[model samples]
Structure formats: C-alpha cells, structure tokens
Target: MMKLDFDDWNIHVGAPHPFNARAVPKIDNGTERPDPRRYHDPDFMREEWDKVFARSWLLAGPASDIPEAGDFFTFTIGPESFIVVRGEDGVIRAHYNVCPHRGSRLVTADFGSMDRFTCPFHSWKFDLEGRNLAVTDEETFRPEVLCHGHDLTSVRCEVAVGLVFICMDTDVAPLSQWLAPILPQLELYDIDKMYVVQHRRSDWGANWKGGVDAFAETYHLHAVHPQTQGLMDDRTQIDLWPGGLSRQFVPFAQPASRYPDQETVNPGIQSMLSDAGVDPNEYRGTAAEARHTVQQAKRRRSDELGLGYDRFSDSQLSDSVVYSLFPNVQIGCHPEAIFLHRFLPHADDPNQFTYDTCILYRHVDAPGYRAPAWMGLAEGTDMSGGTRPEVVHTPLGAPPGLGEVLDQDSDLLPIVQAGARSRGFRGPLWSEQEGRLRHFHAELDRRMTAP
Candidate 1:
C-alpha cells in the first residue's frame, strides 16, 4: 500500500510512497481557449474514460438504498460493471460485477437481495460476502488450483453523507482526504441521515463534458433560467477552494416591493439578505407588503427544508452547495436531498454520453417507503421515446415539474454536440467564472501528459 499526501488531506494507501507530486499551482487567470474537437474526438474520450473515469471516486448507490444485508445494486464505470452488496456481517463491499471464474456479469438487475449469487453462465456460486463457495465440477478440478487466488476482487468502498462511493484503483486515497475542504459543510446537511426521495437517468447526445459543464455555473441563470431570475439574485457570491472546486452562495432574496422593514422579515431571511449585500437600513425602508412576503418565504424554506425553492432565494439555503469534482462527477446539495450527476462516455464517439442522475433523500418520515414514482425515468431526449418535462426555476413565475426541466436540459445536448463539430461554430470560450471547468481541463491535461 502506498499512502499519498496532498497538503493536509490523506490519500489513504497501506504504506508510505517513495515520492510525491504536489498539485500544480492554481490558475489565477487565463484567456478562454477551449477546444471543441476534444468534445468530438473518439481517441480523447476513450483515454478519458480509462484514466479518469475508472480511477476516480464514483458514487455508488446510497447506503439507505441497500440497508439490509444481501442487498445489492449494479452500476457501471468506464467499461466495467460493478456491483455493491451488503455482507451478512453488516459491512458493505463493492466488487467488479464480472464473475471471477468466467466473464459473465454477476448481477444483471438494478438492485435486489439474496443470500448467495449464482452466475447464470457456469453456475459458479459466491456468497454475499463475495467469497467463492463452490463450482459445478469441483471434483474434476484440482483443489489446489481451485483454491489458488480465487476470490471476488473487492474495490475500496466508503460512505459519507449516506452516499456510497467506490474507487476502482485499490491504491487510491480515502474519501475524507479527497473531500477535506467541504466535508464540514456536507455534514451540516446530514446527508447520511437522508434517503432516496427520487432518482432518474438521461442520455445526452453531446459529449459528457457538455452536459456537466452546463451545471457548473449560475452565470447562465439569468439568461437560461428566466423563471428563477427573480428568486435568484445575480449578485450571489462564489467561493472557490484551493483545489479548484467552488461553491455559489446565494443569500436569501427579499424583493424590495414586498417587505416594509427589516424587523418584519424572519431573522434567518434577514441574515441571508444581509449576506447578499443588502443593508439593514435599506431593508427597513422596503415596502410593507414586500417585507411580509420575505418573512413568509423564509418560514416556508425553514419549515420544509428545500421543497420551497420557489419561495426563497436559491443561495440562502446553506445546504445548496454544489461541487464540480475534477472531471465527471457533480454533487448538488440541498437541505433535504443530495443529487449525484455522472457523465459517462457512451462509445468511441465523444459526442455521445450516458448521463446518470441520482437523487437521494432520507427515510425520516417513513422507514420503508418505495422509491418515488419518477425513479425509473421520465421521457428523455434519446431513443428511449418517453417524454420528460423541462423544469424551470423562476422568481416570479411558476416552476415547471421536475420531469419537464430534465427534458428541456436533455434536448439541448444533441444540438450542442452537432454544433461542436459544425463548420460554422468555433470552440467554447471558457470564462473566468468557470474556474472549476478550467481547473478540470488543466488537470486532464496534466494527467494525460504525466509520465
């Protein structure tokens, strides 16, 4: 085992490594020079999926998702199918889904439970702990040969905020060291205490990066999310971490037209408003109706956690932080839930990508509630044929259903894919606000070119 340390963070490995490389200095400023061809290059994508996607900290199904022993779920990363199961010992383990004896996939379905898993191909039996039990023709096989190094190769699995994360590389670091800067903030949301409220997946025609990059910044909120503009003030502050990740903080929004004085507004909303650059004197000077509305929205958000996004400022909620973790995974935090979005390459075509969105909330209200009706999937922009809605967040207007928002976002992907390769269009121009996206590319370049 080789332990790698990056600053105060620990990359947990068994023993210490001989040497180390500190992360390259942060990019303070640079002109936007994004290459569009990277989004359409098959060679580029293949390498990306191999080097980045395979080894990275990927979200496994939620812990609550497989609360009982023998519970299991199948998920894919890069070209490998991985299975997560809870052992009889009550410990969760993740292993490559392929059978150790043959290449047959171990678990085919989404998620279920059993005391043992029998490979349908050759009837190879494995216990829930991933230990090989018996083979069909055991007498014919040499016992020494049979016992020689046969066991399900387990990957490193850990839990944080109730979300299960697996790393294909056994030498990779622990989740805590990698997630140091934001761990405190994440715990504040008590993600581990939450369970799945709903989950959905969509396939985007554009490159994986296109779909994920779209969610990195709120700079587009004003133009792309007109409905949410009034609720979200453009002046929300963005705080970037040393590692290139960042969080957008939106203090609560109180429309001047609604509130008459700062005293009338809820204390929480008033604090949020002040954080957003509103002066107490100015808040007091606001109209009576506006003040009343601000107070009302504040109470609604406080009481419901995050359900009333339409009523409160998107930035006001402390749990509303999102992280653009280096390459493919994006974690969006809400008071009541945690959503994970992963962009996976479909094939050699960089324009084609597999998008998986998983929303996990807690089972606080009910111990054993079925997944939301929206779980399997709504309509997406693909061969799937089902039509999901595009949800819009508006300040003054009504918010669309979640399905509608997902649908709208899915439709734009293919168009972007086409434009990336079109003769008329040029490459994307990354902006200063897109530090994470830029940092992502810089890291990609660094890893690809590393010795």
Candidate 2:
C-alpha cells in the first residue's frame, strides 16, 4: 500500500513540511575535499581553539541541569573550565572555574548546590554570583595586588531553547542572532519543558571533528550499523542551512531500501509498533506502511492522554529529524524527547576527544505515554525530574555503555581516525548525501582562513 521507489522515499523538495516552511535559504557548499590534517594536526587543533571555539557560542549544558538557585555544573573545553550557575536572583551565569588569586581551579565537582564557591586549595571563597567573598588572609597582600578585582572573571553566557551557551569572545553576536537560522525550528519542541533523563561522557580515540564528521550524515549506517537497516531508512533527505546548520530527515519504523524483504514487518518495526501502542499482530500492512501506522497510533495515543501531538507534523513524529549544529553538537528532535550529543576537544591531544551524550524527555503523567523505543534509554531511567543523575564517565577503549548503535560508532571512529593518519590516504571525497560534512568544513575553513 506504499511507494517502494528509493529515489522517491525522501521528502519532496521545497515541500510543505513545518521545518521547511521557515525561510532558511539552502546553501550549496561546493564539493571540495577536506584536508586530512584538520583531524589530527596539533597546529590545526590550536587554531580551531583560537578561531572557532573561542569565537563561537558553544553549547554548555541543559538549562534544566540547574533548575534552582545556586545549582551549578562545570563544563570544560580544551584548556579552560567554566562554572555555570544559577544565581539567587534567578539569572544563570558562567564564570571561569579558576580562582583569581594564584590560579587554582575551583569547583572540582561536576555538579552541586552551594551559596558560595570555596576554593579547596587556599579556602578563597566566592558567592554564587561569582563575587569574591573572602580573600584568605588578604591583609598580607599589597593594596595594588588587592586593588585588582578578585571577583571571578565572568564569561558571556546565555540560554536559548533550554540550553546554556557560553562565548569567550565578548564581541561575538548574541546567542539568539547566532542561532537565528534554526532557532525557530528548535523552539517548536518546547525543550525548556524537558528534563535530562540520562547523561554520559566518555573519552574517544578520535579528533572532535572526526566525531562530528561521523555523525553529520547516515551514509555509513547501512555498512556500520546493519542492525538499524531493518527499522531505519538510510535514504535520508538532506537540508543545508546557513551558519553551518543542517538536518537529515530519515524515516523510521520502515525497512531500508537495501533490505531484501521490504514487505515483511520485521522485528524492529514490530517493536516500534508496540511502543506506539499498536499491536503488531493486527498490523496488516507492508513494511512501508509501518511508519504511517506508528505515526497515526502515536497521534491517537497522544489525544487519549492529552499529550499535545497536534503541534508536530506526522514526519516529525515518525522520523529521525537529526540536526547537526556547527562545530560540535548534533540534536535528534522528536515529540516525546530529544537527543543531545556534544563532541568536546581534548586539551593536549589531537587524537582524543570527549563524547558527551544527554537524553531529555518531556514528562507526561499518562500511564501509556513513553519515549520511543528507538531512543534506547537505559532500563530504569528516571523520567521524572525528581533527582538529577550524576554523569557517568567511561575511560577510553572501555565500553561507553550507551546504546548498541552508539557503541558501534565508538569502536569504528578510532579506526577511521587511524586511517586518516595513513600516508597512503589523501582526503575524503564526500558524496551528495554528505553535504553536511562539506558545509561544516566550509564554515571551519572560513573561520580558519579569515582575516
């Protein structure tokens, strides 16, 4: 009962989709091969820190992480660390994690609640607003030394669409303006109403950009994650926007075109149907109908539970609308929840980076309401915002403890990094599906080569 043509599987160009209706001009980043050195050269990495990381608005963490006054979390990028805290006045602010005197790092814990930040090294104290409270035997110091402000140096911090972003360069555009290209689309999810259900950070044996390139597209999914072929369509519709923003709309609950038997309702499709409150035994349609079936079932379930699915389009309900934010963040948007992935660079090693993952869920009280099974949240995850979970840190080469798809990525990226280092290899020749990678590198190249 559904069209099986692979070429026609994607959303029609200039179609009437909700996200596409916005006035995002499509950008055609030329087909230039990216330099391999950008991934592993230490000099290139240093330049990226100066040009891109320092000048751009980087996603720090969820605003939901600090819901109350004095609640704070630490986010480290390259050689610097920042303390993002909600002040008593209900304003969220970020300050350098280092103490002004003698440069000892403050707030070693990942997250906590405190009226004042006390430096463990010398007992120097600072208020939640980053105002220096105590000087630790200040009378011994000269007036000129003390005259210099002891207050913690503040970083430009702003919140948009429920995420906190910090910019080291004070002169850069405001967060709203920088994200103007995709902000409206992001707002439709009501991300501020969601809460972090799972958080994990692990060191990976790849450059931060390597991780970014891996996630920018799904061209490798059929080859690397064959298990997903049964449930996810690899023929993704790529949309490129300005400011290095791009998204791929991949239909779910349907078999990939490469699958030999597209007529059968496979196990993956059955599981998705069950998650959507549909009985697989009663699903009398072919595999292509599975996506629509789940979408309608989810709609019915939402209406019965007052879950408010009217605002979302049918594609948004049953497809993986994954967005790749420039530099190092990728977001997977859905009605029930959202996935946030951050690839953070290592301070000293060009061959290593940290992969941070957070799963945010919009809480609903109905017994039948739940996140899609494809989200792969761990068993016993706390959906309620009752208690925030501590971040789980996994060492390099150890199991990331993320889902199966991500674990496969973790294992494969290092090999890709190693391959990039080989003398025989020249550079990556991207295909049409890899437009996001080209767009991202173009932005990076633009920054690196700027006057």
Candidate 3:
C-alpha cells in the first residue's frame, strides 16, 4: 500500500467566490482596447518587470529535478538567470547565477552535480551553500570582501505540493500564505517525486502574456485544434485561483478499439501510462469496462498521492486538468503523462517570447510496450528548424509542412499582438468563463500599478 499526505488534498470545485472581495479596477469592454502601448513600450515593460516580475512568486523548478545533494538546474526568470541547487546539506536554494567578482556568470551549463560554483572568468570559488569561500588575490582584497554578506545573492525559495517557486523579493509573504487555498489540490500530483524526462525550447514572435493566454481557455479547442478536437470537447471545465493559478478538467478514457489486439495488455501511452502501471488487459471489452479500468488505475495513482479517493466514482471522467501557476508556468496533467510549458520574454517587445515544452513520464517497460500509432500521436516531432512548431496563420495560408497540423488558436496569437496595437483593437471580451484571464490581467494590472 502506498502512503501519502491525505490531509493535504481536497475536492476541486470550479465555483466563484461567494462573498465580494477587495475592489479591483474594472476594464470597460464596451470601447477601447487594453492599451497597445503596454505591449510595445520599453518603459511599460520595464515597469512590469520590476513591479510585477520582481516582487512575485514565480515557479522555479521542482525538487525532483534535483533529488540528491549537490544537484542543480539553471533557468531564466525575467531576464535574470537563476540557479536552483540542492546543497551538500540536503537543502535546496536559489541564487542569482552571477559571480560577485567582475560580474561573470557562474555555472553556464543546463544542469549537473557540483560541490562548488567556480566562476570561469576569475576562478572565484564558492561552495554549494553559496558562500564566498576562496578569492584569487587574498592579499589585495580586504577581509570584508570575503564576508558571507558579500556572497552570492540568494532568492527566497520554497516547495509546495511538489512544485518549486522562487521570489525575487526578500520580504514577500510565505508562499503557503499566497498559495494556501490551492495547495491541497496541487499536492495530488506528487510532483516532488516526479522527474523531467524531456526538455524542449523554441522562440516565438508573440508576447509572453500571449503565450500564457493561449492555454487559458479550451473553448477554442474544437475550432483551433482540429486534430485533437474530438479528444477535447465542450465538457471540459476550468477553475482559477487568485494567485494566477488555475486547474482545467477534461475527460479522457482508455479506448478499447484503439488497441484491439492487446486485449490482455495495456497499450503503450509513452511515459505517462507506464508510470501509473495500468493493467492493459483489464481495460478491454465494452466502453464501460475500458472507462472503469482506467478510472480504477487513476484511483490507484491518486491514492498513492493521498488525493481525491472519490474522483473515480464519477462514470464519465471526461476532463483533463491543466494547471497554470501565474505569469508563465503551465502544467498539463494528462492521465498518461505530464507536460510543462514556460513562456520567457526575449526582448522589451511583448510580441516576442520563448516557448519551452518539457514532457515527463515513466520510461516504457523494458522488454517492450511499443505502439507506433499511439507513440506518433503523443510525441510531437522536432520541426523547429523548418516551419514554426504550431501557429495560427490565417492570412499567411495553411502550414506547408507535414509534422503536425498548426491550428487557428496557435495562429491567433500574432493577430492578437498586431490587433493590440491597432486603433481598431483594444481590450478583450472578458467573460465569466474567461475568469482566469480576467483574474490574471487584473492581478498583473494591480502589481504593475502598485506604488
């Protein structure tokens, strides 16, 4: 039997708050768009980078990425390169990946295990604890220069529900305070125990917010994502929290017809299904049996995480949950696997953003569970060097490549970027269904305008 923290889990309801809260400046949907100036002006972007990005809690990484002492991973947070390292003492910490001496970058590689960070420029050495231990010229430099206070600048970092988050602000409230309401639900993923199986990166000509907004709603799935339209229908629903976090539920079931021959075995679902250890044979026969078997398997996994024991009781489990942790990180939790996408801004222009996709699932069983068709659909090929991955280009005509069908929703981004600047285009048609978007922009506006 798997042991888990049951008290940390709770029911996930997509209901609006019952009581009225603090007053937020409301946007007028009747006339004028959200200022186009906000997207293009360097001053505006800088202000946001300082007020919004600087003082907020951004998802940095998960503990699983650095399971053992001395393990570390490097990433970018608002033009700043951050390194999350598990020290020799088994404590995980975040630091600005810059050398204090001559301002050289420390640790240029993506990730690895190291006892100390040595600056390539001047050979300045520091331990995994981030302390300035050795200096090149001991005679010339005063003792104060080697003091602990003069060591690497550290950021406030914390782990909750298996997800790692870092704050640039030193005086920010405890992460648990800001993430309390949703922490219980997030614990269901057992993310702390998960590891990254793949990492992908690409650049796009769109705003960072646009990249985030892309995954905010599924109302466009049918029309925008035609290939997977049937996979994600209207029954899907989304629930949003105050801190730029949201959970989307979409129903999915094991298809009996898809793997007819493998009646006694589970069809390969890449790393995802294999991790859950679903019995391939048990999920055969009628649609009811397939659904029942899949649900039972999910219950087994959830039970291991100490979450949602009653979730499988529902017959039609038609929803997949997509969780977005403010500003940039989005987690697509499919039953078979987990996908993470992060949007990083490259320039002052909100029209340009970097898109990264990382998929993590258990490796397929060794003597082998391989299904060509199933694998093809799950693993998107690398066509980055050729045409853009997936973008909606109506006026540009259909995608001329053959990797994967680029849909409208993906294409709609550049248009929104262009429209945001046009006198004709302004604010969006903000609705209750688009509550997450509304909440996101509202919090952004508040932070950007804070004194």
What is the C-alpha local distance difference test score of each model?
0.59, 0.87, 0.59
Tens-digit lDDT string for candidate 2 (1-451):
9934433544442236666453346576776777889988999999889999998999999999999999999999899999999999999999999999889999889999999999989999999888889988989989899788889999999999999999999998898987887888889898999999989999999999989998888789888999988888877787777777888887899888778778889889998898888889998999878998888998898789877787777878788788888789999999888999999999989999999999999988877678888788889888897878889999998999888999999999999999989987788898777777898999999999987
Considering summed lDDT, which 10 consecutive residues are worst modelled in model 1?
12-21
Q: Give one digit per residue, the lDDT tens place, for model 1 in 39-117.
A: 7878787777766766667777678768889988877755678889999999988988988777789888777889998
Candidate 2 lDDT (Cα, 0 to 1)? 0.87
Give each prediction's root-mean-square deviation over alpha carbons. Answer: 11.4, 3.4, 9.9
RMSD value for candidate 2: 3.4
Off by over 4 Å in 2: 1-15, 21-24
Ranking by TM-score: 2, 3, 1
Q: How many residue pairs clash in each candidate?
A: 33, 0, 19
Q: Highest TM-score: which candidate?
A: 2
lDDT of 3 by residue, 1-451 (tens): 8854321211222223321121134232232235556665678788888887888888776566777898988877557898899988888899999998777889877778888999999888898878888888777877776563558988898988666788999877899998775665555545554455545565555678877776776555555564443222334445556666666654444322222332323333322234335544443454324444445555665566544545333322223566777777788764334667777776456667766665544333333222212222335543122211332112224341213532354466777778777777556766444555666776677677778
Provide the clash count, candidate 1.
33
lDDT of 1 at 330: 77
Top-lDDT structure, candidate number? 2
Candidates 1 and 2, the one with greater lDDT: 2
Name the regions of candidate 3 deviating beyond 4 angstroms. 1-33, 142-149, 253-318, 362-412
Q: What TM-score would candidate 2 get against the native?
A: 0.96
